[model samples]
Target: MEVVQVLCMKGGNGDTSYAQNSLLQKKVISLTKPITDEAISNLFCNNFPARLCIADLGCSSGPNTLFAVLEFVTTVDKVHKKMGHELPEIQVFLNDLPGNDFNTIFKSLPTFQKDLQKTMGAGAESCFVTGVPGSFYGRLFLGKSLHFVHSSYSLQWLSQVPRGLESNKGNIYMASSSPPSVLKAYYEQFQTDFSMFLRCRSEELLEGGSMVLTFLGRISEDPSSKECCYIWELLAVALNDMVAEGLVEEEKMDSFNIPQYTPSPAEVKCEVEKEGSFTINRLEASEVNWNAYHEEVFSRYQKIVADRMSREKTEFVNVTVSMTKRG
Candidate 1:
């Protein structure tokens, strides 16, 4: 709940907005396209639904918000054509936390709907899209209401920071200096959150319905892996640097925890088995460069900014990220 109150992305198409920084997220959706295609294949193996209900959980406000959704729409249209079945009426739910810039998403829908109509041809009339705002950690829809669900680069966010991390000092998340207790707290929290997530989806999805989730994950159990918590470690370093200049209170740094976790594949599999709801059809992972765009551009930009801020007494850089769905 605190995460919801404090969690908001860089709204609008500004320099630091999620709308601009989300190119990496768009890339993740593309990288996981095969998984989504396989899930859609299973969804339509039998008679396709005349009216199909799909939900894109953690659909943040950005130009790329509809990128994955349109892919699904096209795939569904193609499969029905191949099977000689009528195209289904598609009702899409774009979900995110309350703090999301839904205005941006809604504003763009007018153009999106028009483009979709042109692309979908006669099938356009059957397609409907609406926004569903709230957390996905709990039940969000009626029982058996959803046929297919997709989440991209979300779900790593815990419902809240793990309990008992207040004792953790000087770091915002699990880092090299973090103790065993902090790691244990994070692990337990993830188990609880992931199991709850599965349970809720189980109630909402029809029998044999499919879901595809692509989020940040660890390659191993080590919590300090560069893949696991390097981002947080860097954040801690930056915050502590500010504290040294008497800019930020030490207590503030100690109290704040990044309300997210990068679960290992084994951890996710274990939770699914414990939940005993959905059958795991496909599980795969691959490493990709963190910067999907030109890395040199960022390096040059950082250098220019560092030169200008040499004697700054305070630094207030508000980086609104497109990671609320579960990042």
Candidate 2:
């Protein structure tokens, strides 16, 4: 599929002050720590560098991104303290799409620095955090320069829309009664994106470094289920309504498609194993009831659509996959 970059108007500022704090972000961060600690301990125990370089890929501008990175660093600090060793100088790189709202990220940095200073202490080793904007499929750091990499709520986005859909063979994502074409397109994109991710990370990670990623996913191969996700349906309804109202052309709606894709747990594991560089230490899939937060966020989403779109839609459900990586 020819990848089409849909230019979407920026919606929210990535803040959740008014949204319900289901603590989903906190839980994911907490779950991420033990895996990170284990990997770092194993990779750097004997050859702990004075400085540790880490990258958080697909780090959207928000408290969630900051929270996850802080939790990981704090955990590492505790591990070093328990071992009677001084904490390594930490350097964290936050990465996301080029269009991401960097102002929001930058504004939060002072608070992040203050908390870090308090937790690790002013006399403790220094830790530097900076934002790097780009796609993860490409190079973002110097070769063999990083000790660890982490990404959350990212990677499920296809690098581009799948091709061959005009012929009815189906592409990476489409609105249809049956979703086989959608599934195939998603699988192909994942295969490409996963390969690029490995190739890029391999170039930047030390010989024994590790990576951890969390993303939305599915447990079953069935594509036409409510469990699969309802975002497609909601979008279809919204688009149809807009077409009926002559807000957007019918042809434009036909060409537009969702940029997201959700892989099954088995499919993800297969790709990781096939990559040959990463040793899979853990692969877990779980149902995440974001209902509380969904209720709050979707309400806001509906209002946004109502102003621009012709209809309102319901909340969509999503599954989550957490994976650990080792070189």
Quote the positional error of residue 87 for candidate 1 in Å.
0.7
Model 2 segments more than 4 A misplaced:
1-27, 123-125, 167-176, 291-327
Q: What's the lDDT for all of these models? A: 0.76, 0.66
For model 1, residues 131-156, the per-residue Cα lDDT tens digits are 89888899899898888898876788
Tens-digit per-residue lDDT, 1-327, candidate 2: 333233222424534441124256556656556666676666556676888898988776667767777776887788777778777788889987777766777888889888877887863347778889778878999999988888766777777766545432221144355346655765687789878888889889887778877666666676444444555554456556666788767776666666666766677778777877777776776555433223433554465445533443333233333333443
TM-score, structure 2 vs. true:
0.81
Segments in model 1 whose C-alpha atoms lie over 4 Å from true places: 292-327
> Which numbered prediction scores highest in lDDT against the true structure?
1
